[model samples]
Target: MDDASDDLPGVMRVVRGHLTETYADLIDVGDLDRRPPQVRDLSFLSRALAAQAVRILTECSAPEAAAAVTDGEGDHGIDAIAVSPNGSDIWFVQAKWSDRGRAVLGEDGALKLVAGLRRLANRHYDGVNVKINRQLTRIDEALSSPRCTVHLVAALAGGGEVTFQAEQRLTRVGQEFGFDGRTPVKVHTLGLADFHTFARLHAAPGPVQITATLTQGWHTVHTPYLAFAGSVPAGEAAAWFEAHGPHLLAPALRNTRSDRIDQAIVEQLVEEPENFWYYSNGVTLMCDSVQAQFFGRRLQGEPARLELGNARLINGARTLAAVAHAVAQHPATAEQALVPLRVICVDNAPEGFLSQLSAMPQSDSHTDLLDQVAADPQQLRIREEFAAELGKQYVFKRGAPPPAPSAGCTVQEAALALACAHRDVSLSAHTSAGLEHLFRPSPAGAYNRLFGQTPPGRQIWAVVQAHRLVQNALADIARTESPWRREVMDHGDLLISHLAFQSIGLEDIEDWVHSAQQDPDWAKQWTGDIVRSLAAAVTDRYGQSVFLASVFTDASKCRVLAEIVSRASATGNQESTANTVAPARRRRNSISVLVDHGRIPDGTRLIYRPGSPPEEAAIGDWLHENPRRYLATWVNDRQRPLIWEADQQAYSPTGLIMHIWREAGWGEAPVAVQGPARWFLPGEGTLADLAGELVRAAALDGGA
Candidate 1:
């Protein structure tokens, strides 16, 4: 005997042939063989089972001719194109085939198929733009049109995995590519089982045999018999009837005494036997009895009372208590009960029970009776009253009697009264709002309003001082013909010279003079003092604003201050000072300072001055104490003093500043003091250490 797996193809072939023949009226010519083998099989089966779909489209609405299969490339991966009979719209079909057994398609495989379709679609469109035209032009242009509808059909030899991911991917792809516009692309999988049912419905013998081997040993066999009066074959009809026909007659047949319904109900009850009784009694009464009698210990009259085999009333109380306890422990089960309650109360009796219970008075005479009993002179007074009402012979009954309410007794009324009390005890809206008001901040709106405006005067003053320094620096550069000055001036020249000089005939020389005067020594000095004052104030106020200290105490800030001081010192002798020449002794001393301090590496010499040590310690100290001033003074002096000698070459003040600043902090000690001289050449410690100690002292003194 051939294996069942081997027989699948034969069975599929028969199903395919039967479907093609049965759906010939609906199938487009030449489409039967055009599809892939698996797809063809699916189309065959889908047509057979989708007879209602065909009737909905064709017979009812008079659909246009069947869509034509087209070999085209488009953004939506449409393999075939079709138009409604009236030319109202167009439809595109993407057919996929797989040999995997009848399992839902996996996410990865579905994604891959979607990707393939996307690639085909991308090739058809020139760009992002989509065009619509009815004319049958080149395949790409036809496919690229926006009016087309794309449908995805997965034809699996058996059902491939139809996962949630696959479904979502199909939906998303259809939306992105405008498959069916607002309607969405229709995605479905067709399997062999479907084909067998379809074949049976449309073209099979009167009786069909379905055989499978059970793992336990015996072979299970099913032979469905059917009577068909239509063009569909008996076998096909039998298969269809087996799968779908039962549902149509199920309701009527289920009402009768049928073994199928009985067996189904038995199986269902076995799975959830509690549901049998739960639904039998009205669900609301069952629920309330559980809450009141079982869990709550406040019994209300039973909504459902059934006669037991022993002729006693089996109230919902015990069951309700048990179910209520179970539900309380497992909240998930509690929520699931709401649906069943709505279903079981189909006649509206539960609603009536709720209404009746809700209408009861909150308090009655029983409350007054209880109060009276509580106020009795003797403890046994209430007991005596109760004993007088009962007969002596009935005192010790086999089963305990149900507890009775005092005086104007009504359990439902009491429960309703308790519920009302609970409602009244809940928090009031005013109390909740008041609690929120307590923790809020004072003047909350003030801070937000302040934040929306400009900063206060002190901050603006600091910014203006910084702007002045930048202006001075630019002005100084404009006055000098040095390469550094030239570079700095070029940017301004480009902007100003373009319109002011060339077109407006403004004199560049006059412009430079006016700009230079605005950046006078007085203005620069004022700005520097203002900035220093602001920085000091901030440091005192905030205490630990290190970022502010770094910016304000920088060498550039010091240099600006130093320039103003130097200019002040040189005022009266302005012309004479400018022409004054430093003696050979001073020059020689300066060179010696550079060498001895190791500003020039060992054995390095300067040609300008080759003798005497230049009060190296004093010069270095002054440089450290007022770096910006020293830099401004050095630049203003015409004597070009070589600062460092490396490779027999002299470095300028600007070059030295760049190198020193790269290694140290703003407003820090001179390079000569902090460099390798003191520590490397037999001193107790380095100049760097001294500088650090001095800075620390200044900081402690609140001077920095």
Candidate 2:
């Protein structure tokens, strides 16, 4: 397989670049900072292609796909195994990377994979490696389930299907997995074109091209541009989104938005789909070029075939997302909907015109409330302060990608923290009800009160950090409690945070921040005490039968609870508070054990510093480019803790570290990382250090 003979050189180059960025950790490529994809060995490219196959076919995040790789010693022929989040779907993937852009799975390879599947189905796991062993629990569950569907994926970077004999071998394996006259196993063979398309869409190397039919359409070819105005089937609009996801939007508009707008669009599509065309403002797509194919006269009620190149939906992202959701939930009703659509082909438009077009106000606006505050003098000052004083990224603009939890805070978070830090219980209630209510333009409103005077970035960060600790402590407690108690904890987070913040006197806020950071568990322990005392105060004040969910939102009731809790704290009833709460069951995982024992809580932000000097040099620029990528959300899972914000998916700390390394073009990422050691808890030491401390303490207690 020679690169010179490759039929898809352009596509291959793009896919190879993406594969390298996503799967560099799968191989050891020496101490080079980066290397050309062509120069990489066949094994590295092939393994990356296999991981890409798992990622694309299973729709798992890059880290999850990488974690699925089981291609090493004693792998039998299986390259990777992808199990769905719910364990209801699984894919056993084998792939080949062909430099000449063609790979065909021979009969021997197919048979070997089938044999591996058979061994897995029969629960024979004698010789498998740790990777396969780790996944055995999920694989067994998926195999035993009657409803689960297993897929054998033969993915290649070349242009051809599996050999006929290989296909036959797969069919026989499928029959063996069948039960109750239903075949649970299926086969999927992907070639070069499929990989190319996936790379284009998912990697977002360029603007996505979409072909759609516009009904009852009329086109106008002006001097510089072409425009088409018509009605598009809601189904077609959704299909575009389904195929391309966020790539349908202009580059600048790809950030996550408030769900309120999305919900409104869904409600319309589900309830009054037929009138959607009239009630909703239509979508506008900007294209670099357009090719229109029509059967009859272009203007005389015939559907126009549109092949748009470099297409971007400049407006109506919410509508598109909502329609897609509605179609999935209630397909029959949603497909009946017609949406007004306009496609503008600005083939020779002047520079910055498309940007201007995208920036134009639309009839149906999905603007975030924070966008209004972005230009405010006070907010701008705060943003600058955060960057200058704390060396943190403070994002105030809507549609701007937020900084990572450890790196910075958003205006919304700052406002909420400030509100909770305020002594007024009503401010907490206002914040809990809806963030938008607090953003009202009235100078005398919550917005002014929270940000009227410039607050120090350190103070804001301290409050936000403490609030996060409180949240984690509460979530840990919630997991062990009954449904009602859990709901109260969930719904009353802001109120509880307010109580905790108020309990820490104004003069001691900085001192508490320093102490808590130095001894991370101290914050959790104190929060747990406050929570227990607050629960008691609530029970004593409103009786056990009272609905706490309703009580937390009412300012007057919260004030009373605050009084009771404060009085108990002031009278030194800390021992009684600790005695009131029940003990939690011990968990095995160190992270989970920490949470269960009230040492660390969920929602804690962990800093992911590079483990090695070589690694730091590789990824430092990438992290500097986007600071949010430096932080990962912590969860109390047995194996994985860090949740990646890019896809809102969970990844083991080391897996996430590998992913970051790969993404940063680190050619020589290590096979293993001291995951806990790399994740630091602010002023406290690494998670590895913290866990060791807990272990030593437990040993001391046991000896005692």
Candidate 3:
């Protein structure tokens, strides 16, 4: 088959942007610095493929902060690996960057990837480097579980087909590891053509297989498009959006808008879902083709359902989100909430009109918008006023594309920072939460108090960058054989860093940020200060590997870590004392323990304590019975125990009484029973005690 040269420019554009955004710094491009600087051009085959693999890891899979660049020597023929959100699915990507642009993976090339997968699945990781071996260890662990599904992928920059023979070879490799056809490893062969299709789908996901009730019997109506008008249950609408996340808004790296509208839409869905058909502007679905099957009319006095295949949603992301929200709130009621939809099947490509559809306004939302708290004139004034103070743009709606990276500080960043820093946590939320506003409709004070009385956005962009620097630093630290490797949370740690960046013992941190923004010299010194602080933190607690463990496990400790870092920065120690995460502890006890009191700094209390009732056997039974009772209440009453805050992307300690008290809002904690009084005093125990406390907390959350 002949490869078309025409697709190169567009495909490469997505590829290029993907490369730049995927990495926070040149360090992420690990071996590139070791090579001749020009080799870092990244247009080179191996590097390009590695970058693309990174894109697949983050974009196709969960946006793991761990998605890394591995184009260096000793990579073991593996470009990247993405652990699925649940840790059950793993994608081992082997990419070939062809100067001639061929996308085909011959059996020989596929064998290289297959060989590595075989080694990893078989737990033969000694052949790989330390880093790759660590990931392989995790892969091997997941493979032992019945739920694990590994994907063998061959990505190409040019056009070449993955022949049937290559796929058969991949199967044989999986079979060697006991993966039969029933639980066979999934295989994907992608070239530039597929990348283009993927890009388009990402821009607007389609052929989503939606089911709805036809407003009228469908006859092929074909002038503008082969079309059908219908009604869909809000639950089904929610399903579609959840299934096609980010694809529905492809090309946008993250949903970085600052508008509180999804809640209102959901309110309408719950309160007057019957009027949803009337008040709704209806969803527009684009598909390459569609087929509908009648599921019979309902005797429940509503429209009958028609199952439609290959429906891609183009114009109703907000509605989809709202439906998802409504369904989340009232599942039974959401089953009853029907929404209007228009399904259009087009043989022609859809890129041309999708953006136009996205721009088109749905009128009913306007009525709700009028009633929104953010829409109140005073809140509008505050938004405008805050925007003016920051000398930035004031965005007015949800789903508005984020301002360009160089377009100064964004409201979303400001709001997210406020939410993490302020008392009003529920004010601003991730787009997935669908309520996005902390700066407007609430207190101008959240913004005002960012610097403890001034809008932090003035210097926030720098702080955000500093936050990223700290995260990248932590990631670098975690790569070592430290016990805290699995404990790093990028964004949550960033919030803690931000909290530290605020003024504390030193001059107000915001003033420093503002000053740093104005002066490059100050900025450099400030960055060095933060780096040193994190370094010292990494090395703290007598070189204990769990030094910054609390930063990830406890939100309160996250705040404490911030203060620790800030104080270090204030000390003006230009050199970092904590260079690497400390080695694992030498355990002296089977039970939990913490660092010695003499070694532990002031304001730092022992977090891990193991002395409980001596009846260990009965305690096990007690834990087994109604195990999730505590998990349910502390994590969630209805939803699965959210051991991690999805929006915050941070871990929580399930067994910790204070964390449970705060997360579950279960009144005040029984301080005497679960307080500092029970801590393992200085020299009372070895660091072994802290280990089980952290491990148990993590296990509790994981089980929950």
Candidate 4:
């Protein structure tokens, strides 16, 4: 056995030399197969071939020897460990030889291999742990100090369910018991097809010819000539090469056969005569003087135009080559900013190729607006003022009147006086200045009497009067020949047309009254002609059209329309005040609904209602009317009390009973519920029912 192994290297060298001489362009001669013993048996022959081929290409070395090992169960199993040349690393290789006389491994086999390795790594044997423990300890120490790597090699002989099974098992092991410190343990696999390629390139001619006999009664060797390339008769070899050579060679030359090939050819032409006459098929095509001059001009940074005839083989390649050559020869200058240029050709390119070209790096040289602004101080100040209110601060001397006395004494004094005046009469220095620009002053005493410090009742009444005045002014503006007036007129026409079709008269006095009550401006714009239209619609439909009148009368329904018209009117100084109303009373005696989707912890109080307002009585009445569908509280083993309150009072009740529910296995998982049912308040069910039902619904919807 030692003598045979010693001659293996010499045999491989001879085989590699023959292959290199025969297929110089195709094969890398430096790479040659080195067979592993565990895979030497006829049953594991393909594995041996694949292991050797991969080892050669990757410059990897096989282990010194292989042996069989068992867990003291009397099981005869081979443990082929391939150690790296450095002896510091090792790969536990396992081959699952098929019993069905097929070349490929099986899924069960792969799973068994993964399981066996995992057991080996963890098990302790023979008064001391096996090398696996020592390996793992070294790995752990290496990880703490630096990085460590481990490899798992799964060698498969043929194709079958084994391939898929092996991949899945490897993935599972990697995920579950990650490498040394949970670091990745690399896994490499060699399949049957790869093995055949290796065997054809490295096996001795005589032995290779006997491959079919060796694999007999096992895998059915199809086309042995094609399998080992030259192991069969000459006639068979010719036929196999003619049929399958292209298929085998395509992937290897895919990168070279790219669309840029034409471009590469053209670029080569731009070089000297010595470079242009390069050989591919041992045929050198010389460039004529004209072609040479054209390429010369292109190389010299001068634009050269070529008009190759309609032969696509020559023209397409020439165009692409020319473009690529030009780009390569003449690069962009720093001062002359580079802009990406993409040429989209619908010719024969794949989809999105043009888009990919367009995405290449390019320069966008444009002046920055902020940088320009930074060059000027006056512009910066103006920008700052536009961003915030303009104001100045100044210190007043003890004996002197405030600085800028005319502007207003001190800033604080001026601010305080303005605030006080605004509170007392709803007007401040700002308001006074704004008003002065719009209105002439009345006699001083007359103005003082109307807006001076006065009783609270009088002040309130005056403010209401002023508000009404502002509303009336805005109403006048709505009646003017302005853009807003025209828009209202248009919408009004649309409204009248709609009502007329429904036999509702816009001219009806009741309709006018309703419009006036809701919006004074619309009422003012309802002319006699519009009114007549309304009247006709009303008479035609009788009292059935009364609903149309009510639609226009409702204030809430017209709030949005009112706001639009108010904002459009030039004199609408009180537009902001038009919709302002007293805040609603905080409702008490209210039912809190809490639905914890397990995102919140148990006993987490998400909703708290401190006190109940008078409005809550209404809510309570509503809840009382619907009891069967609603549950107030629910508790489970995983969740705390759903609802609780402090104390109760009439006007300001404290501590109202809160409705709560705990729906286990709710939302995401590890479910718990605590809080009111605020999330499900709109539903008909009570807090407890909502929580339980929602969880059940989710689970059922998921087909749980």
lDDT of each: 0.31, 0.71, 0.47, 0.30
lDDT string for model 2 (1-704, tens) is: 24443355788887777776677665433422265545545667777777888876766677778888887667888988878765657789888888777778989989999888878865679999777899999998766543356788998887757888998898876435422123446788888887777877675466789986877645555655678777788888889989987667775564322222344467777888888887677788999888888867756458778899999988877777788888888888546999888889887888798768877554343254466677688678878878886899888888789899999988878878877877667778655545664664432136655664455566687788867767877877776765545545665788888887777643345556666666655566777677777767766665544434345545676777778877777778854432222223323444655555666678988888875565677678889898788888888775567797666778876567757866777643432344666888898888868877888788999999
User: Which prediction has the highest TM-score against the true structure?
Assistant: 2
Off by over 4 Å in 4: 1-58, 62-78, 83-90, 98-101, 119-146, 160-166, 178-183, 202-704
lDDT of 3 by residue, 489-554 (tens): 322344434433343211123334344445544444444344445445644622322212222323
Each prediction's RMSD to truth: 34.4, 23.3, 20.1, 35.4
| Weakest 10 consecutive residues of candidate 1 by summed lDDT | 422-431
Q: Estimate each model's TM-score.
A: 0.21, 0.36, 0.35, 0.22
Residue 610 shift from truth in candidate 4, angstroms: 49
- lDDT for model 4 comes to 0.30
Mark the regions of model 1 whose C-alpha exceeds 4 Å error after superposition.
1-11, 20-68, 71-76, 80-92, 98-152, 163-168, 174-186, 202-704
lDDT of 3 at 488: 30
Task: Give lDDT tens digits, candidate 4, residues 72-155.
Answer: 121112234433332324455555433232445456656656665544443322232242333444433322221223455555
| Candidate 2: residue 445 Cα off by (Å) | 21
Local accuracy of candidate 1 as per-residue lDDT tens digits, 1-704:
11223445666555445545555565433444665765555554443333323222222221222224332223233334443333323343333333334435567656755764554444423422121123244433323332223345554445534678877887776445422223324565656666566556533223222211111111111122111111111222223224433221212121211111112222222345445333222111111111011222222221221111111111222222333333434444433332112101112235665444333321112332234323433213323423453211111111335333322212222122211111111111111111111111111111111111122222122222222333454455355444322332332221111111111111122223234245455333332332233233333432321212112212232233334433533453222321121121222222234333444233322221101132233244444554442221111121333334222233443334334333333221211111221222123233234334454565788963
lDDT of 4 at 689: 52
Which of the two, 3 or 4, has more TM-score? 3
Q: Lowest lDDT 10-mer window, candidate 2?
A: 578-587
